[model samples]
Target chain A: MSSTQQTEVGYVVSSRDFLVYLDGLPTIKVNDMVESDTGLRGWVTSTFEDKIEVLMLDEGAIKPKQEFRRLTNRLGINVGDFLLGRAVNSLGVPIDGKGLLSRTKTNLNLELDREALGIESREFIANQFLTGITLIDTLIPLGRGQRELVLGDAHSGKTGFLIDIVVNQKNTGVICVLASIGKPAVVVRNLIDTLRLNKALDYNVIIATSSSEPPPLIFLTPKTAFTIAEYFQKKGKDVLLILDDLGSHAKIYREISLLSNKSPGRESYPGDMFYQHAHLLERAGNFLPEYGGGSITALPVIELSLSDFTTLIPTNLMSMTDGHLLFKAGLRSQGQTPAIDLSLSVSRVGRQTQDQMTNLLSTRVRQVLSAAADLETISRFSLELPPETQLILKRRELIMEILKQDPLTAIPKQIQAILLALPFTTFLQNKNRSFVEKYKVIISEAFLKHPQLIPITKSITKLKTDEELIKLLEAAGAVLAKLCP
Target chain B: MNEILSIILKDTYSLTSLKHRLRILQSYFLKTFFGEIETSVNMPLSPQDSNWLKSLPSSFYQKFNKDNIYNIFSGLEKIGTNTPILTMHLAFELNDTTLSQIGAFTRKTFDSPSLLLDIKVDPNLIAGTALSWKGVYRDYSLRAKLEQKRQELLEEFRKFLR
Candidate 1:
């Protein structure tokens, strides 16, 4: 459609916030681009028997009987290597003021029917996508193609967790796509700055629709991000797509639906809300080798209201995703950096992808933590406890301290394995608690610097016996003790 | 000058005579309950459109004597605004025949003879006519045909080259 053509003129019948009901054009599709004579840009959202509702892309004055023309093409974005390290809106227009992206354009709503691909086309997710966070890498290990929901309250380190994962993917060769829907512009800027500071921006693509943007664009951001990720996925490259939070996305959809006169189902959310999110998340999976053997790991964040997991959006996401990393507000207050509640958080398919050594070590850590939690509860009621229980509580304290990692500092999987295995060894046993605490950094540093340990750590995944793991841990402990002493 | 007539041009076959009847009814309504017609017509309906019946003013009940006012607004809502729709399909420029055909189609499509046809051109259609009447869009263009048989055409071209 030529932009110069004055082909179809529609007059606005009624004007609402971000939505205008126009009369005359009856053939607009759900996502057809529409532009007004007064320079207002929008897209057709809903079509009724007689009227069409348009969601404005900008906050321009739309009076009654305003003329609008339907653009011939559907919404699209430029997707290629040019998008890497750049910030763009849902429309793929560069918002970072870095100038226009001159690349081959592709339709934003390219549908990938996973159901038609059949079972044989998809590979078994056997490889681990390490986040470098000890808590996540060990306790809730993520498979390359898994969709994990990160649930937490506001300011509970949810974004920080995702940023850390993206930062860790820097050298790992995973193309990271962060879709910030309805986030403040400043927050998006800060996130981009953080990525640049860590030099991870080279491997990152930031697709953002800020809070001030129209609801339609905000709703389109995540889908656009997924399309970009899919573009790279088809090239046999792994992509990590992080939707910062789906809560705001859901709210934006609800707003658009209400403005379009759609009936609200639960909590005033549109009825198709569940299907809306499920369809987007369903696009992510590990494809077969014939399909380039690529994977798009989606880590969709959901902010909980008062740490309530039973809410409408959270429940819908929980059911759709593989499992969730529940970041507790209480844990955050207690200074647990990631604030992940191990008992509540789980990875349904991650254990299968982990090495036997990691599996063994994580299992032990879980047991110790669970025991400590139980003891803490029991000791709260009683003044005294058994010596073994006391020691378990002490070990838990040290383990918690070890898990307190600085944001964006992603520990290598091998390093995480070594650090986790230390609690089970004689390195901290019988030593003064303070002395062990003080020397913990020295021990980790020593383990990280060992040249022989790198190859041994790589081979640890192949080791079959616990006896071999125990011997290796003992040898590593002896070396660490000598270095830290 | 009636707001209803101005927005309902394309669906004039049924609404043309009804538009005259509504103008009379609207004038009478204004005389009895000044500006109430605008308020009643512009009142927000429930998102589901289920509560629209009950949300009507009680004064409308006494004045209209029957539920004719409700029926009129509901009908008005269905036909939408009277803006004439003209959808044009072109390979490039709007030829004389295509322009005249579109003009004739618009006049015949709507009850209001004064309503102008809205024209939109799609160069992708290659050569054909695509019409948007009332709220429906129909494409009778060669471009659409090419798109439908794109794969077959590609194969045929490849065979011809061989």
Candidate 2:
């Protein structure tokens, strides 16, 4: 092709607020590729009654009447197994400077047909997705293909919680996609480094669009990551996608919409803002067996201001998701590592996914904690309380101490069942605080030595009655007492 | 405003033809103020004008009264200054019939039909056409095809040498 054919020139008429208005190009469509004579690239954002507006892809000086040409190519990226252990931007360009990805590519705007998957194809979510965190695995049991929102105030261990989940999924054969939108470059770099150090990057794909990038690219990061997750899910692999925060994604979208001259509805967000998020999240679910019986369990994080849960984006996500794990700053101040508020956090569908033993253990633990919380509030006013209530409070404190887990140390599901069941047994009641703490360590060490016990605990799913479950728990307790004593 | 200009520019060839059509339209607007513009310029109530009149929506005719017609012309001039007319850059010139055929094709492909074809000769193209419209270029020339298949042709020559 001749040089003239390589470049077809259209004059820019005006420029302002990072948007350039071009005089020519009557055939230009919205989202069409555009480039300036000076090597600046952009996309046609809107076509007014006269001039067309182009959103610049790169920051540079674009002058009036400077010629630009349409590139005629839509934005897309390659997707495949090669993407695992790699870091990419919204366009799937390798931002990690690793190398080129595989040649098998797909469009970024590839539409997932939620209707085609349909309600008829969906199977009941019976299998539990283990996060390996004892507190979460025991209390808020996550079902496969469930979308659970993680809401927390700043510095309340939200990202730490997600990182722990990713770390726990290491050998579980779950492909993890962590999409970070509008985070600072340093934070993103640290996260990638953490994943690398933990060796979790092998089974993970990190999609990072930083805070400094254009709002449009930042807004597209999670959807691009979801598309990548869906690619793996189509192959029948279980995928755990953690969107670090949708609050920033929504803000970036609002910024883009306002810049494009759209009328803002509530809190300066576009009217379709909720639909935009809902549609993206609606792509996640358990598909029918004919469609590969795969699952994508989404843990979309939402940052709160001063522990406020009534914000527009948070409430919208809460309604869309199965349930939320509300992280509390107050709990963090009180030295809770995960900082999760037990009363506020819930898993609506996780109960169906739990086996008999886990359900029984979780119900007993919740009862002790709830009764302790009420008695403690009353004890704040009255120094003297019922002796039984005092014992429940002491037991609740020990349970809380047991749940205070460090980051990157995810307990296996079987070990978690054994450890949680130890507190509910009669042997621990009326025990001194120091003795109970020692007993906790001995129980952990006992399970660590006898890995064979995990299989026995797992096989207890065959137990037909509560009597059988009680007998098994008592037998396990007796074994632990013999080893620890 | 663009719609009116597009209809005027559709079959118009030269600057003289464009001016003539505008004048006829101006007179028609004035006559419609008194009663109705006689249907045609060359002959009153001609079949072409009657057909054109019948082809338009009733709402369009009702809205484009004498006063609004002036606004349409002013709006067209304003649009001409603010928005550049669609231009097609062609590799070579063709006969009027062929040019009209290409013009009609462009009208159907693009949103606007009031396009100006800027013709230039490039003998290097060898036989096929090359055109650029609305900042997008398409090269369908014979030279382009040969360049695309250069590797395959070179392989054939290597086989012959062996």
Candidate 3:
């Protein structure tokens, strides 16, 4: 196909253009040109007062019209899909042969150079974004508006985890922008295919900077993505910006540093590597009351070693973010889908959403897990222990049971609270034997029935009319009293 | 540490190709600056590159004669003059100087014939003026660019796969 010369005729700041480039085309009356290219020789779909938009006909169309018609839907430049395992170039072009992404108003005002909102104007992230995965939704919950760093070694599911978050957010009606930088051609192809299978390409916008591109373009990928997200956010939308991996960004900065003839720091990196990363991660926080209609949640992945976190980049980011979810290669080796090492993972803002379920689960599960973790440490030293120690062991075992979950399992909030409210902690307080023999089954059954008892659970937490609460109690009084009592 | 230094020394042996040699030499200086001195792994320079290194500044030969310089140029086989490479090195004088001052000194003052020396101030090197030219090599830059690239690569590679 022959190439067309595309040029910016004028810079439109808002509605006004400063200067214009007409390419010396013949001029005709605006109304007269509406009929053809001599006037404006393109198909017209619609017209407005200020301007008329038209699709340019291929070079060989016969008898150009004197008047132009605005054909909004008839434009040949359709948007395509780029899903998981797909590769795209810097200009939002599909390099992975996935076809163009499904179009959705491609001509949006996508602007860059956004001024970062001040910290005082930022809101604290408290809401839990439910990922139908039981382990994530119930246990190590991820909070909305939090800057979460997903780190792993090579091929350790860093990109996969980001995709899962985007796919799950579909239910929340959240817009997702997957920004890929310095990614390989083959991997991009795979990502697009995955998105197509999930039919998620329609809801997502992908911006990629391939390894073969210049440093400036690679650096612009994330910024351009944030600009797109800003568009969605301005419309009161929740947007997730996923920087597949930031290592490449750091590399770009290093190249720039070398070219600038700056002194290299440890590992031949620029002295300001940490600052560059911090600047991007800091942009992920939620804007406050003044800015309505949007929040951006960024998941920037960093690859690390089996147990090493002291490396410069990981350590710097660890302190910058609210916290990180460590996806262990060893766990993946054991066939874990998320490969999240719950023992070391945490969400600092997770406890902020204090409805019945979150409160019950976070407090009770944490108590059991913490106690069990300590007891396990002691158990290794001595075979024999106090009676309380045996009880602690039982409690620890129960905590592990709660932690046990299928990777993709999505647990409803009602079930999440019930599992937390179950007297697993009390069971640990009792004699280890009886608790193991009887209490375990009793608590498990209660937890399992939690969803069925949701009417009561909602009533218990609802700060509303008394009649609904009374009706809920009447329906599930026996179970409620039995557990809480 | 020794292995790394040796690798760097070996790489820098092709001194005639200024940039490559500069890159390798900078690697050595950075490690030394960071207290990570590695043993020199000098590769034998080809006769052509060796003759080019030999034709550098008289002071370069005087300070680091054949024996001392051999440790630095063992790996480089040859660097034909036809190539474009930025040969960057630093030279320490008794007085403080800037790049312009050194360049002025070499162009107007220093009596040299075969080696064309370009002097520049690089405070990253401790109390020295940098000598950057094809035939001659010196070091005294405040910092090294190669070290920065290596560090960036290590950091990025660690995160890229994750």
Which is the leading candidate under lDDT?
A: 2
TM-score: model 1 vs. ground truth: 0.75
Clash count list over all predictions: 8, 0, 73
C-alpha lDDT score of every prediction, in listed order: 0.75, 0.76, 0.54
TM-scores of all predicted structures: 0.75, 0.76, 0.54
Q: Write the per-residue lDDT of candidate 3 for residues A173-285, one digit (tens) a residue.
A: 77788888878756766777777777777677777877766555576577667666666666666778888777677777677566545699977788988877777776676
Candidate 3, CAPRI quality class derived from DockQ: incorrect
Please give, as one word, the docking class of candidate 2.
acceptable
Q: How does candidate 3 fare on TM-score?
A: 0.54
TM-score-based ranking, best first? 2, 1, 3
lDDT of 2 by residue, A1-485 (tens): 55434544567888876677886676777767688867888767678876788877777888765768877564445578888999999877888878887654552344322223567768788889999888888899999999999999998989998999998888889999999998998898998899999999999999998899877678778878888888888889899999988999999888878877789998899998889888888878887778777898999999999888997999999999999999988888887889998899989888899988678778888999998877887989988888888888887977888887777787777767766665556666656556655666567766667664555566655754434555566667667667667
lDDT string for model 1 (A1-485, tens) is 42232245577889888888887775577777788867878887677876887888877888875668777656666578888999999887898888877644452334322222456768888899888898888889999999999999888988888888888887778999999999999999998899989898999999998898778789888888888888889889999999988999999999888877789999999999998899899878899878878998999999998999998999999999999999988899887899998889989879999888778878878889999988898888877888898778877877777777878787777777777666666767666456655876666666566775555576676777545666787776666666776
The list of candidate 3 runs beyond 4 A from truth reads A1-88, A95-106, A138-140, A334-337, A381-387, A423-485, B1-162
Model 1: CA > 4 A from native:
A1-11, A23-27, A103-121, A380-387, A451-459, B1-162
Better of 1 and 3 by lDDT: 1
Measured against the true two-chain complex, the DockQ scores of the candidates, in the order shown, are: 0.13, 0.24, 0.01
